[model samples]
Target: MVAIHLTSSFLLIRHFIPFMKKKGWGRIVNISSINGLIAMPGKAPYCFMKHALIGLTKAVALETAENGITCNAVCPAYVETELVMKQIRDRANQNNISYEEMRVAALVGFLCSDEAGSVTGCAIPVDAGYTAR
Candidate 1:
């Protein structure tokens, strides 16, 4: 989980940030989870990695902001992906609620665009208000 959520980002940033620095523009968007902002019962390891990912996003944002680069995270809710479905099945008895399918691609797209140049180091939630509770 650490490798998947943290190390991969670190490697990608280390690899590509040099080019971004040369070009003087870049955007790094990390797909975090709503769990990064909140907590789920019995998901300590997963939650820890997600939270660390947000921390990484912030640190990278600060490190590269002076070079016209922006780094942010989009924290979406359960999206019915195969991996999530497996977890859902394992916790079926615990959660009986349904989730509206909220799209995150648009938010990611915006974060990658010029309009969001000043929006670095944010963990914007696309969780259909789940974190509001």
Candidate 2:
């Protein structure tokens, strides 16, 4: 997960940086997971990948900020998207909770806004305070 996701994002950004630099304004949001913020049992690969993504976001943001570019990561513990519904559902079942309770979508929305123009190099969590523990 770390190698694939990390390398792919780097490659994609490498190909696009020139264009965004030319425009003097850009925003790059990497959709990372709360695993990036903390650890859990039997989730080493995921945690490693997400942690790398946060590092990448910060590193890239620093390198690009001078050109009006902002790079950040949004760390979500669970969301009701089809992409990971099964995983969230399984977790919810194990925890004796409802999957519906995990459908969060905030950090992404915030980081994508014009008001977040100066909020670069951050891995803001959208995990319903999960990482606060």
Candidate 3:
């Protein structure tokens, strides 16, 4: 889980950074969860990895800020992917809570574009206002 969530991103970033640096422009976006920002019961490993991912995003963003490269993480709550759907089902059953879907593609697209060149080192939440609570 650590490798899948955190180490893989680190390795990929390390591998691509030089190429991006040479090219003079790049965008590195990571998919994180609300767990990255807030803690929930019975999700320690997942939360830990996600939080580390945010930290990685910020650190890498700083490292490559001046090189026409940006790194950011999108922290969404229960996106509508298959794996997430399963988790949501399980969680809903366990806690008897309602569910909602959120998508990060548009924000990710914006982040990858020239308009967001000035935006870096951000853990932007796309949690349908759940973080507001």
Candidate 4:
């Protein structure tokens, strides 16, 4: 994940900075995760790596600010993706619960409203408000 995400981001900045320099404007949005902000019980590695990515985004943002390049990290908690469904299943298995139960427990009553968009420069908990409590 680090290689794919961080490495690619570094490469993009290296390769695209010249173009951005000529154009005088650019926006780079890195897809970070809420794990980067708040640690979970069983996802230490993911949390650590994502935190690192956030750091990278901040560094890049600072480096390119004078160049009119904006680098930011978008931290979404849990979107309804296939990979997330698999995680739900895994959680179900780990907790010995029904899939539906796990899904509800995973998502119900813990979501963020779209207006939360104002939050940035850190992880955004789109996890149905998982971190709210």
lDDT to native, each model? 0.86, 0.82, 0.89, 0.63
Instruction: Assess candidate 4 and give its lDDT.
Output: 0.63
lDDT of 1 at 40: 95
Best-to-worst ranking by TM-score: 3, 1, 2, 4
lDDT of 1 by residue, 95-121 (tens): 443333355777889999999999999
Model 1 vs. true fold: TM: 0.85
- What are the clash counts of all predictions, listed in order? 0, 0, 0, 4
Better of 2 and 4 by TM-score: 2
RMSD of each: 4.1, 3.4, 4.0, 7.5
**Worst ten in a row by lDDT for model 2:** 99-108
Off by over 4 Å in 1: 80-101
Stretches of candidate 4 above 4 Å error? 85-125
lDDT of 3 by residue, 10-102 (tens): 999999999999999999999998999999999999999999999999999999999999999999877777768887666555555555334
lDDT of 3: 0.89
Q: Compared to the true structure, candidate 3 yields what TM-score?
A: 0.86
